[model samples]
Target: MAATGSRMGVVGGSIAGCAAAVAGIRAGAEVTVYERSDGELRGRGLGIVIPPPLHRRLVGTGYLDAAMPTAPVATRVWLTRVPGERSAREFARQPSAVTPCNWGLLWQSLRSAASGARHHRGLPVLSVGHDGDGGALVRTAGGEESYDIVVGADGHGSLTRRVLAPDLRASPAGYAVWRGTLPVDASAEHLGALQLLRTSWVTIGFPGGHGIFYLIPRGGDAGPDERLLAYAIYATPPEDAPDGAGHVRWLADEHFPQEWADIVARGEHAAMTCHPVVDLHAPVAADPPFLLAGDAAGVTRPHTASGAVKALQDALCLEEALRTSPTPAGALRRYARERTPEGARLVELGRRLGRAQVELTPDWAAMDQGSVDAWCRATLAGTSSYLYADTD
Candidate 1:
């Protein structure tokens, strides 16, 4: 694969798409990025964390900046309610090292890093194919174009994945995540609890659900006091749970912590977002010049805490493959071969964790410290480690 004069097209202009563009350029390819969104992507998303190990890897590889604004997490406290308990009881507390990130900021950094490439905004790729000579043909609403290589960084509904692996689809995991963010002032009444969680990420576990909440840097150019209370509540929706924000409120009221409930009750109509949990993986990753990256290749459960890490890693690996392989075909296949197993493992780990934490939960009231540890070990048997160490 000669680096010079190679043309590469990257679908999707979000985080993974931008990273793919960067990879293509670093490999000496002329790159073009196609983003479906018309306007500038606003920094809007719940808290996203990059584990310390993955953080170091990404920063070392120039995919992430060391100085990115992040809230350093010092502890993970798991709380549950028992029959006689007046308040949430903490049965497990572990020293946790995690860095919480605002998703929009991360995307902005990746896009800036890939500034060398030409980005085509407001264009959505409709389909993809091969040019019969190890080249890729991409069809968008505007027109069709050919490139030496095509990367599907488009999210779950990837056109490249549909062409490459039509059978692969994201399946609902029988649960949902009701997520939202609240300003620090919105949670002023819980100042004491907020102080306790200054350096801690708290997880409140119930019979069939759990909520993880932590402080995150506010989006955009936020001041020092500007912080957000990010909460993700996972639960099985009730029969009458209305769609959209109503469902978010229903789930939050039923399962989330009281602090989260209070924030939701503040009458911020657009505060919450509801998303159905889905897991999917494509059996094959690459077919010559056309390849899949990020969620297009496989979407692991957020429980693995490797969604963003895996996406960035995919682009980084693709960059290495292109730089080292003798042929473009070889590079694409090598990237796929190396990443498929890691994707499968993370998806499986997510399913396992989801089952343990949501579907088939343990009786929290009856578990002791040793029991909790044992349960975690048993449920996370194949997940490598709590911090996603094995994948690295």
Candidate 2:
């Protein structure tokens, strides 16, 4: 294996970093991880969804635990609020299968599997670059270290990504996404919405943008109390809008269905936050002693829902490349060749999806399965995605 007996430095200890560490170890490399945050990053984010096949592949490959709790959704229901209507109008339904996971739980699973790596917490990488002799160097507040190869899983503002694609920066999408998780309530009033979540994921459309709602396992348990109602609501936040839950409540109360709005606006969540949507794809995935993965390689709009999926695939592909290549350079070359184009494709797909779903503002109320299929065809523009590839 190309990575056999080699020293691998993986920057960042989140999902991408942990997964990269697992890849390095399995490829016979000695791995070390640098995490900037000293505290547990596990419970920070709310929800993540990936294709069922990809989830299965990660589990089979040992990147995730087999018994990890996940809520698998089979169909996506599109709804739009009708004025003076108590219930939202279900305009379209499609076979959109995915496994929804709590971000914390998923990261914990990966971190456990990658226990072989010496993980350094609260250590921030000051800079990373090629040593110019078929190796790389990572500098931190603690000290500097040299490695046969450095995997920059440090995310979008990565110091390592600058060494490869300094000019690359994420472009804003002129909107923002409000994300949070609500405690699932078993009250009789909310049973309808809760039942809908158990059945399928729902997309509620408004004028400027839309919202996605589903359930994700809270911690590692089952039952209504163990389930959390995770949501991502997108829209152009009006100028001078309130911050935090205030903005979320304003958006929900203004655009979402009554019951749906109540769910997102009802809870006091520690994870409630908002961020502007942006995207970027590195021009190259690797260049010899330096390689990129996850957000370090690219940041697609959340509409694509491929952020974590792309990262897991990166680690899987890296391990495969290193296992087969005769040298580290050869492995990096193969990794770059396969992932660069894929990153570009996902970025392009994300832009198209953003335009169709958010900017262009589709007529959700008028859409049925037929128009929805047509819209999907036009939006996808011949691009391939697991979400639509298997639909009838």
Candidate 3:
């Protein structure tokens, strides 16, 4: 642990920020968190996945618990549409273990874990800079504060990153993911018609893109009323396709299976959020007093299913560095050395997958189980292996 006198500032009080505050406090540093938004963040409902191994590691670290609401996923099925078929034909089924989580609920848990740390909301961070004595200065909407260290958990558009690495920015990867979620009925009439079990995460592939669907807890439980169907469709829509859910609904009509189409059409457009997929990797993750973590350091495509895990891992790395290194500068250097390559690797893997899966897709109709297995192995190579490489 650092000296009790050591102080740290964490900007962006979301998932990464909250985790960082926990790390700082546990390292014996006085920590303060500044969140830019005023509204309750719990309302931003979304779905996230944690592979079983990483989930176990986080639980061991007390960052997560089995009691947290999660929908267990046992298999991932890859399917393709066939002519006159109401549902896509399954090409491959890969045995897997994952826990699908509600984004809001996960954030609430992390926020609770960091409850002891001072958190200031509705205060936007304007700028950050280095102090001459190897410390940092944070300028917020209210005023400027000094700290021994400043962490950038502010996400893709980070002010702290501007001071650390001015040239790095999140670049669009030439595609977008249209996502939607809606309540699931107990009768299971809607989802049951699709012939997919609740334990399955289904992936349907077409000419220009793919879609994935699974269940997430609405109130952190497995009860029927607590679950919602969450889906994400990845594709490069026509230049003239309507924005947001309209584009997603149009794609559903054109490419999705009949049953899948019905599920999407039943959803209200207001519940969907569509945005371009972007990626970033700042060549260096830290510069003296200013250190970057989470989306500010690097961003891999959602296909990797590692965003939340990566962010939490960043906090753990920061904690380890502070706990082990002899000096603050040395610790920052070590953290950067360890995370930079991992960040670059994820970015490269995302590009490779984006190219093979979206840009230059294979003929789904022609692929057999063998070919599907080979293609999937090639595309997803190294992903599972890298899940908890540093921590484990």
lDDT of each: 0.78, 0.87, 0.78
Q: Name every residue pair that clashes in candidate 1.
A: 1-326
> How well is each residue in 142-253 modelled by candidate 1, as lDDT tens digits?
8889998898989888988887888777999988887788777767897655885687888778778787888777867786346788877777776676346666565556
Worst 10 residues of 3 by lDDT: 383-392
Better of 1 and 2 by TM-score: 2
Candidate 2 residue lDDT tens string, 1-392: 78999999999999899999999999999999999999988777889999999999989988899888888989888888986674788888888898999999999999999999999999999988767677998999887899998999999898889989888888988888988876676323677778888889998988878899888987745552367888888877767863455876877787778888777766656467788888888999999888899999999888888999999999999999999999988999999999999999999998998898889988677778788888889889888887776443
Q: Give all TM-scores, in the order shown.
A: 0.92, 0.96, 0.93
* Regions more than 4 Å wrong, model 1: 82-86, 242-257, 264-270, 386-392
| Winning candidate number (lDDT) | 2
lDDT of 3: 0.78
- How are the candidates ranked when ordered by lDDT, highest leading? 2, 1, 3
Model 3 lDDT tens row, 254-273: 77777777777765432578
Best by TM-score: 2
Question: lDDT: which is higher, 1 or 2?
Answer: 2
Residue 370's lDDT within candidate 2 is: 87
Can you give the lDDT of residue 292 in candidate 2? Answer: 93
- Write the number of the candidate with greater lDDT, choosing between 2 and 3: 2
